[model samples]
Structure formats: structure tokens, C-alpha cells
Target: MYCEITYQTTGERWGIFPRDIGEFQARMSIPDSINSGDSHDTIVKKSVKIEIMSCSFTPDEKNKRHREALEGLVDRLVKAGWEQMTERGAEWYNIKFHKEMQK
Candidate 1:
């Protein structure tokens, strides 16, 4: 099975393997830093889409079950204000405001 996880922040894209979902979440956990405390940051919003390809699984499973799970995870992140970047064909979001805490 192959999966392309697209993030739409800074237009950067990342390729994700089915088994590497943990790694993907970890990578996204990194916080972004900005200089100038006087500067007020503007929020960026983006739409998300998860594209998947599985040889063994039926399309219904991929689109319904697996995709739902993936979107659910993403929804949790997005609610925290993660926006996607468009880079290459993949999508990525820039999330760097929250201080590092235990997830």
C-alpha cells in the first residue's frame, strides 16, 4: 500500500508510507519559530485531501475506512490551526505556534 500525505503550508510536500504513520505525526509535531515578538501573526487556512493507492485493498476500504481514519487524525491537527502547504504533488502544513508539550 502507498499513501501520499499532502500538506499545504510553505508549499512543502511529504511522502508517507502506510507503516510510517507514527513518523509522519512526529515530523508534524515540530514547532515553527518566528522572530520579533512584536509581530502579530496572521492565520493561514487550507483545504486537505488524502490520496491513497492500495493493490490488495478494495477502493471502498481505502476511501471509507482508511481514509476516514486518516482524515480524523488530520482533523484533530487542523482544529489546532494547522494549514497545508503546496509543494510538489504532496501537501504539508506549517504548524509552529504551540509550545512543545507531551502529546
Candidate 2:
């Protein structure tokens, strides 16, 4: 198992967080890694490609900022233990990341 973002904020906690602003999300803290028997951080995050939950992309500054912020947030999440996952080698690319799959 990889590191889990057990670290939380004051208002509320979730397995997920709001992906609106990068700085806002940055204010939050992730759980500190635990030491393994070897006296080192025992956990790591999986390398997965995750994208924002937006329905569409706009060619504007705000959209650009949001996208960049989201990317940064993903990196932070990975570092903090919110590891990424893939089934058919597809990257996670939406807010409803865990939706019903087609049979």
C-alpha cells in the first residue's frame, strides 16, 4: 500500500479535496509518513496520470491557471499519498474518477 493522505484540514476531511485553486489546496497538509522497521518512510505513491474533473477545456487564462493548478495539486496529492491507479492503462481524467464502467 502507498502513502495515504491521512493529513487533513480543519473544516473537513475527505478521501478527496476541492480542486478549485492550487494555492488553496496547497494550504492543506498531508499526513506524515510513518517509519518502517528500517527506520525510513515506508510508503510511496504510485505513478498515475490524473486530470481535473472539468467537462471541457477553454482557451483562456483562467482555464489555463485552473489546469496548471490542478496539475500541481495532483503532484501534491501523489506526494502526500493520494496515489493514482489505472485499470486498462488509461489515466484517471475526471472528477467522478470512480464511475461505472461499461461492460
Candidate 3:
């Protein structure tokens, strides 16, 4: 399973997180992966889509359970001001954000 983050405004991709960040409350909350670490900075407010792909193949018990977990994660994140991207064909968001974060 995978979870991807993107900036909705510019269609810029943030980063793609695997099941490591997909587990329920693993980092205490899914959005913590995107947090600035400075509480005073505040959330970007502009919406972001945290897309989860539980299956790139035919469904199976493992994938089904994975999908369920992703769905729950998405729901919790959405309530925290993020949104979901339902456009299956949406292009990848900008890669620079991911690159910069690596530095």
C-alpha cells in the first residue's frame, strides 16, 4: 500500500509514503508526516490530497485489509483540513518539494 501527498493548488506532488506511514496513528496522526515541526507555523491551509493506493492489482485479502486502513487514514486526515483526489488520472505533483526535504 502507498500514500501520496500533493498540493492541490499547483498539482504539485509532495511525497509518497509507503505502509510505514499508513498504519493507524503510527506517527500519532497521518498528517504529522507533513507537519513543519514548528507549531507556530500553522497548517498551510490550502488543501492537499493525501492519495492512498491500496491496490495496483486484483484485490485479495491482504489488499482488502490494506484498503480499509487507508480509507480510515484518509477520512481522519480529511477532517484535519486535507482533501482527497478522486481523479484517477491526475498527474504527479511537483517533485522539487520532495527533493528539498531530502536536504
Considering every candidate listed, which one attains the maximal TM-score?
Answer: 1
| TM-score, per-candidate, Cα-based | 0.31, 0.27, 0.28
User: Which window of ten consecutive residues has the lowest lDDT sum in model 1?
Assistant: 19-28
- The lowest-lDDT stretch of 10 consecutive residues in candidate 3 is 93-102
For model 3, the local distance difference test gives 0.33
Positional deviation of 20 in candidate 3, in angstroms? 9.9
Residue-by-residue lDDT tens digits, candidate 3, 45-101: 222223334333122225555455445555555665444545422423211111112
TM-score of 2: 0.27
State the lDDT of candidate 1 residue by residue for 17-73, as single tens digits. Answer: 332111113132222346434333332322333333323221233345445644564
lDDT of all predictions, in order shown?
Answer: 0.34, 0.32, 0.33
Over 4 Å off in model 1, which ranges? 1-26, 29-61, 88-103
The best-first sequence of candidates by lDDT reads 1, 3, 2
Question: Candidate 1 or 2, higher TM-score?
Answer: 1
By lDDT, the best candidate is 1
Please give the clash total of every predicted structure, in order. 13, 2, 4
Residue 4 error, candidate 1, Å = 10
C-alpha RMSD of candidate 2: 14.0
